[model samples]
Target: MEKAAEFYTLEKGILALKDQIDALAETDDLDKKDRIAALRSEIEKEWARIVPQLTTVNIVQIARHPKRPYTLDYIAFLFQDFMEMHGDRRFADDPAIVAGLAFYKGRTVAVIGHQKGRTTRARIDRNFGQANPEGYRKALRVMLEAEKFGFPVITLIDTPGAYPGIGAEERGQAEAIAFNLKTISILKTPIINVVIGEGGSGGGLGIGFGDQTLMLEHSFYSVISPEGCAAILWKDQNAFEQAAENLGIRAATLLGFGIVDKIIPEPPGGAHIDPEQTFKNVDKHLYQALKKFEGKPVDELLDERYKKIRKLGVFEER
Candidate 1:
């Protein structure tokens, strides 16, 4: 197996901080300001220490962080009252892919995204943030509604990939994924997508189709993951470090390559380390992207999307 990249996770920092904080608390003679300052300084130091070294593999871990924000978490924090809309209108509701109409940035916007769970039981419950065929269908269903109603769409991409089970395939996984790209091609309302975590494969693309796309600094977007890529190319999963570097999945590389339109700077370490600060940065980027697309024509939006995607790879002379 590929070595888990060496990096401090948010949980680790939090746990370490807790120990120090508890020890400080037990010392009743300490001044309140001194204790608080010491705790904050420790966190800031750790956050600064780890920011520069976050790799694609380390991002994978953070994207799957048990406490990292999810679709519902953001909805609760960022939106007004949210009314969840469920079902693909054919099968059943999919918790893995949640959709809803919410009031955001002073207007109604449709939001959808993959939600990883905090525990093993919850991961199984949400299918490890991997959507099924029906999940994609449900997202498109909500997006189309947003289009018809002229509500802007906001999609948070956090899926490792769409489900690859027999049922998902039988339900037309490839077709469902294609249908998303096709439907969003002509959407009149603006679409904003953010790769908050692992934007893996078609599942990521299912909601990744948008007029403007932004990604977190530590987020990753790739056609396939490092492990899968390593397994395929070198037939050795242990080559993950090489696989991650070669995949060019980091936001900086992806933006340089034109695969992503904008990159939102994350909090010092990662989203998990300072969730509030991460969301703050994300909020700023969201409004900036949304305002820029506010008055653009559908034709221009399509052209921009096509141009951005078409020029995604290198085109130098051999």
Candidate 2:
């Protein structure tokens, strides 16, 4: 069974007990109530022991958990009065990249993110959130519009990587991604980026630069996915476990490297288990971050942003 994985064993066992408790609790017997209470305690103990010892691969699995919330899910919970914008005028709209204007705590902001659909059909339609050149172009257009109106930009990054399709390359995928990096770096408005899920490659970077870069506790951000890394380096796709360890993609690792500005705590058992609490935690931090940049001059913001970027990967000679 899939639950045979070391980390899943405990979680699956807890969930199974919970299911039994739920069924038994529906009865009128007082013994059943006692049994349910005992099961709950056991679940708590199992969770406490298992979560801390989770391997990087286990965290990666949680990050990609099918039930875990996605970009659209966060947008729905975080923003109000969302009005989705579509298309790169030069080409057809790309469903993988969702861009628009929305009200966030009474302020209108431009929002862009890679959107992965839930179902098989929807995933095909969204290209599994692997954006193409036109998607990047559409993102650029919306971001430029946001700059024109002086609205802060908020980007949620969650892509496996940009599409590597033949047509995407023919249409200049590299140029499109490069354009976003160049333009977003110096935009006069404040921007915030949150890596809500897998932050893979240039696809993540295309919308990732911001005044404040935040990451969820269990999320992973890397230049390439572990499987890709394993295949390239070891010629063995099954060596992903080794790749994940060496990649330094965890939020804690990125935080230690000064790559991410802050780490937002997720609910116990990952965000999927308690999305409401996760949403609240994110909202609080995002509001606090926005407030920090409030009233700062655009020139100051730009200068500080440049300084921050320049400081990455710097080390003093010993």
CA lDDT, every model vs. true structure:
0.81, 0.87
The regions of model 2 sitting more than 4 angstroms off are 1-10, 17-44, 314-318
Top candidate (lDDT) = 2
Q: Residue 17 CA error for candidate 2 (Å)?
A: 6.3
Clash totals for all candidate models: 0, 0
Candidate 2 TM-score over all chains jointly:
0.90
- What lDDT tens digits, residue by residue, belong to model 1 across residues 247-307? 8788888778767889988765567666777788888899899898876887887788676
Q: What is the lDDT for 133 in model 1?
A: 80
Name the weakest run of 10 consecutive residues (lDDT summed) in model 1.
1-10
Q: Residue 151 CA error for candidate 1 (Å)? A: 0.5
Tell me each candidate's TM-score: 0.89, 0.90
Off by over 4 Å in 1: 1-15, 18-38, 316-318
